[model samples]
Target: MNTLQKWLGPVLFCTCLGGGLTLGWSATTDLNKKRSSEVAVLQNALYDQECGSCHFAYQPGWLPARSWDKIMTGLKDHFGENATLAAEPQRQLTDWLRVHAADHAQGGKIQKMVRSIPAQATPIRITEIPYFQKEHRKLPLRTWKENPQVRSLSHCATCHPQAKEGSFDEHAVRIPNFGPWKD
Candidate 1:
């Protein structure tokens, strides 16, 4: 090949490669920034009054939108309780949950939670998550059965006092009768 043709091909290839690298890096940086945002709190008063009345109004960022949709539609059989809501309130809660669901939420915790589950899995409870299970698996059975304060892992606030505020920092964990969580 002629010198001009050979040099031109290499130049074009390098330019395209550099451009691709720059775009990829920019996208990764943006995602990292979103994932590193300060802890987000569930601020919806209506959600607090409606869902929180029965149980901890779980942070929407813990599960995917599909899971929320399934739970919202199946409230009549919600963990064996009649949690049926009026159409209007149901719509509002569903909307709120969908907007803040794990797949859409920003933060490393949310991203990791989302990644831990299969794309098709529709987990109604955070405790059903593999990541959550693995994290809590170290705890003995007594913590769930014998411990009066912690009857179930579903009771997030039992150990994580800041759960209502949407914070689950390991450093903040305090188990009843067991003292602070180590590791």
Candidate 2:
């Protein structure tokens, strides 16, 4: 009826709406940060022992289930080495890897890695993933070849000190002789 009375209702509604939106935005942003920060750490002891014995026990989230399946099936000639496991352990590792692979991931860098691959592509090597290549494109070939401490990009832990822990944050990288990466 009067100017003050008429304006109060709309003012209160607008204030409540804005406050709700602010809170919602804050919550969403935090969730996204948590998701995007890292992939899941290697949790299977058998995988860690069997794979880590020869190379970095790369988190399964780096590749899709199809890729993991391919890799598991080809362990006899794994990257020019015979990495064949016994029947039981091999089956168990394959199952675990597929379950946690990128395609099945909820969110985070793992999901981004999955999205980078073509739907038809089944890349057995994590280094072959488009996302992995893009992220490492800035590095010179010498870093992987000449650096005694970092002989290959496949050696994720050589630069990503926390790769085992599933933390691939660029800020934490220490590229052996090359030092900290900045890009």
User: What value does the lDDT take at residue 34 in candidate 2?
Assistant: 63
Off by over 4 Å in 2: 1-35
Reference-based lDDT, residue 85, model 1:
95
1-183, model 2: which lDDT tens digit per residue? 699999999999999999999999999997667656688765788987898887788888788889889988998899899988999999999999888878866666787788999998998888888988999898887877778888888988888888777788999999888888998
TM-score of candidate 1 against the unseen true structure: 0.77
Estimate candidate 1's alpha-carbon lDDT, on a 0 to 1 scale.
0.84
Give the CA lDDT, 0 to 100, for residue 125 in model 1: 85
Question: Candidate 1, residues 28-61: lDDT per residue as tens digits?
Answer: 9875664454235658989989989889888888
Steric clash pairs (candidate 2): none
